[model samples]
Structure formats: structure tokens, C-alpha cells
Target: MRARNKPWADDYLKEHDEVVVQAPFDNKNKWQDFFGNDQPIHVEIGTGKGQFIVGMAEQFPEVNFIGIEVAKSIIVSAVQKSLDSGQKNIRLINVNAEDLRDLFGENEIDKIYLNFSDPWPKSRHEKRRLTYHTFLEQYQHVLKHDGEIVFKTDNRGLFEYSLVSFSKFGMELDEVLLDLHAYEDPKNVMTEYEEKFSAKGQSIHRCRAHFPHRN
Candidate 1:
């Protein structure tokens, strides 16, 4: 579903330029310097409303969190959340994650989170899925040789397909949970979508995968 247009989104973004990084592309290859820390950077693609990223920032202050949200309506809320958290380890980028390499340098990103991404169930639209082979390759371009992709979804079909896709790419499946909440892992940060849907008894599927070492 498309996000409802927020008329004031543009104004809000401009007002909070500090949190809503205005020129993310220019920061490519320089994210660590931007953070002014040697701590690892973790990225959340399709970050909706900022819940997961903000929560993670607070939980793991040792890590830097970058959220890439495409919807202007949604990113504004993320920016506000970061401000409220009073955490300096978080940054928001109002842009699509279609081509991560454009915003990150090779071997720059340490980890990526694909939280409740669109399932894109139709076979014809498989390539559009965030976990699609094409998308995985794009991730490889920017992630370190040992970097990991953490994917979560409520759609069973997409979960199954992604698991197979990861294997086909020779990516190691470090972890796979058919019913994530059943584990009740303390480290799992809930996205707004995950909270709403899981409340209705929708099981969340999750996995951690690593690309083949390019070295």
C-alpha cells in the first residue's frame, strides 16, 4: 500500500536537516567519518516510521544506525523519533534503497536489515523483492566480505523464496526462524508493521545470511 502524502513532510525534513541527512549520496565512502566513530554501521532498508531503527539505536549504542526510507511521509516520522531518542548514533536518509552502492562505498556497510519488506509475491515481480538475487548482488557491492543481511517478513511465500535465493547465491544462512516470535529473542527489535501484524497472530519469518567472500 502506498503511504498517504504528508503535505508538511518536505517542510519538516528541511527543518530537521541534521537528522534527515540532505545529501546522502555525497556521504558515500565517508559514513564512518560522518559518524566520527570506528563503531560498525548498521543499515535498515525500507525503514517504516522509524521504530526498529530508533529502538536499535538505544539498545545498541555501540553501533551506528542508518535508516533508508523512501516515503517522504514516513521518513519525517523517523526523523522525529531520532530527535526524541536523544541518541547520537542514528541518522536518517530520505531515499530509496534500490541501489545501495550509490550511497555506500565498497566494504563500507557492516550489516543490513530488511524489516518487513514488500513480499512482491507475483512471479513476474520477483526481481522487485528486496531479497531477490539482483538486490543481493547490489548488497554485495557495498557490504564487507563478511557482512550479513538480516531479513524478516510475514509473507510465507517470500520467506521461502528468499531462503532458496540466498542459498543459490552461495550465501551462508547463519540463522532461519520460521516463527520468529516463538523464540522471543531479546535482540529482535520490532518494527511498527511487525508489532501490528504479529498482534493479529501473523507469524514472522526471519533469517541471517552472508554473501560469499569476494576475497
Candidate 2:
């Protein structure tokens, strides 16, 4: 289901530009300065509503969390949630994934998260998938050496396709979980989409992939 448009979304974002950036490119390499600390930075590409990012911030207060979402309405909600959570370590950007390289400098990010992303099942639309090779290349460029991508989804087809994409790109999987809910990991944070799917007996697939180390 698509998210309904919120009439107040724009005003909401303007009011909270501190949490959701109005011009993320301006902060490109100054992310640590934005957070007022030099802590490790973690990003979530498709941050639907900031649940996972806020939870992670609460758990790991030592890291800074940045969430990027394209939908204005959705990102507005995320900004509100982050503010309500009172986690000073959280920040959000309303921008598409394609703008990633333009927003962060090389080796700037320590880790990235992709939770319950769109599968984009059609073959012709494969390039639109977040795990596409081009997207992985951008990820590698921005991610620090040894940084990892943590992905989760209920779509089996996307999961399988992503696994192949990762391997083909010469990336290696550090961990793979066929049934994330069953794995019962204490550190795993569930997005709203994941909780809904898991309640319907869906098996959540998750993996940690990393680009090869520099020579």
C-alpha cells in the first residue's frame, strides 16, 4: 500500500529542518559537524518512518544515524518520530538514493541499512533495485573500508536476487539469515513493514554484505 499524502507535510518539514535537512548536499562532508560529534555514522537508505533508525540510536548512543527517504510525507513522519524519541544522534534527509554519492564524501559512512525495501520484481526494472551493481558501487564509494550493508526483506525473490547481485559484484556476505524472526537475535530492530509481515507468518530474510578491502 502506498503512503497517503499529508497536506501538512511540507510545513512539518520546514518546521523541523533541524532533524530533516532542507539541503542535504550542503552538509555533504560535514555530517559529523551536523551531529556535533565525530562518532561513526550509519545510514538507512529507505527509511520509511524512522523506527529502525531511532531504535538503533537508542541502542547505540555512540553512533550517529542518518535516514534518507524520498517521500516528503513519509520523511516528515520520520522527522517527528526522531524528535519525539529525543535521540540527538538521529538526522534525516528527504532525498532519493541516487543522490547518495553527492550527499556524503568517500569513506564517510561506517554502515548502511536497508529494511524491507521495494523488491522491483520485473527484470527490466532490476536496475532500480537497491542492490543493483551500480547502487553497490555507490555504496562502496561512500562506505569506509570494511563497512557493511545490512539488508532485510520479506520478498524471497528480492532476497535471492540480492544475494546473487552481491556475489557478482565481488562483495562477500558476512552473515545470512533465512528466517530472521526465528533467529531471535537480540540486536535486530524491526521496521513497521517487517513487523506486519512477520505477524502474517512471513519469513524475514536478512544479510550483511561488505565490499572487498582495499589493497
Candidate 3:
């Protein structure tokens, strides 16, 4: 069944100023203007309600975070949540992840987070997956050398596909955990989806992939 369109998206359209980019893919190199300094910038491609990005921004004040969500209504809630939490280092863009290269310059991003991305189940729809080679190529254009993509998902098939994709693209994988909760690390930040799924006794699959040097 097709997902119903979110109605609250219209309300967010009225408060456009709160959103940093009205059309991100069109202005690829303009991101530097939004952040005056060259401090490391991290991006979250699909920030479903903004919990993870906001929490990370608050936790790491020294870094800047940019979240891109195609759903305007959800992004509005994320922006409002960030504002209410008194966070100053985060921004949201309403756009498709495919257009990331058009919005960011070469080697401009320091890190990327792909938390609980949509699992396009059909084999024919595999290209639509965020971890697909096409999207990874786009990410490579914007990510700095050694920049890493931290991905977490509850879908094992998708995780396996992503691992192969990353390796085929010459990216290195590390910190691969089939069950995130088993890890004793405090740096783990759970997203809204992760929290809900983990509560239901689901194991979260996660991994970190980095671009190899082009020597």
C-alpha cells in the first residue's frame, strides 16, 4: 500500500525561513556561506524526526550538522525540536538525497549518518536504497578524504547489500555490529526508529564505511 501523504507539510511551508535551503540541489557550492568557518560538517540524509541529529549536535558543539529530509512535515518537527532544545549547530534541508552532490562541493562534508534508512524491499527497487552504489558515488563527491558514513538499520538484507556496495566502491568498513545494543560504548545514540524497534526485541545492524585514499 502507498503511504499517505503527510498533511502537516503545508504548515511547514509557511515557516520557510526556519529551513536553511528551499532548493538545495540547485545551489551545490553555496553551503560554505551558511557556515562561515571551516569546522567539520556532518550530514544526515534521512532525519526521520530529528532525534539523532539534534542529540548529536548538542553533544558535539564543535561540529556542524545538516539534516536532509524529503518530507517537509517531518523536517518541520525536527527543526522545531532542535530550536526547542536550544541547539545552534544544526540545519535542515528539504530535498532528495540524490541531489546531495549538487548541494555540496567536492570533499566538503566531514561525515554522514544513514540511520534507519528506508528498506526498499523489492529487488528492482534496490537502486533507491540509500546505500546503493549510485548514492555512494554522490556521497564520495562531497565527503572529505577519510570521511566516514555511519549507517544503522534493522533490516539485515539491506545491511548486507550495503556492505557489498561499500566494498565494491572501494570504501573501507569498520565497527561492524550486527547487534548494536551488545556494544558497551557510550557514544552510541539511538534514533527514534532504533529506540522503538529495539524495544520490540529487534537487533539493530550498523556499520561505518570510509572512502579509501585515491593514491
TM-score of each: 0.97, 0.97, 0.91
The CA root-mean-square deviation of candidate 1, after full C-alpha superposition on the true structure, stands at 1.0
Q: Lowest summed lDDT over 10 consecutive residues: which window, candidate 3? A: 13-22
Superposed Cα deviation of residue 173, candidate 3 (Å): 1.0
Models sorted by lDDT, best on top? 1, 2, 3
Show how many residue pairs clash in every candidate, following the order shown. 0, 0, 2
Model 2, position 69: C-alpha lDDT score = 92
- Candidates in order have lDDT scores of 0.92, 0.90, 0.83
Off by over 4 Å in 3: 1-8, 11-19, 23-27
User: Residue 183 in model 3: shift from native, Å?
Assistant: 0.3
Expressed as tens digits, the lDDT of each residue in 1-215 for candidate 2 is 78898999888888986788788898878889888889999999999988889899999999999999999878877887898898888888887758578999999999999898889999999989999999998999999998999999999999999999999999999999999878899998889898899999999999999999987
Tens digits of lDDT, candidate 3, 158-199: 999999999999889987999989885588888989999999
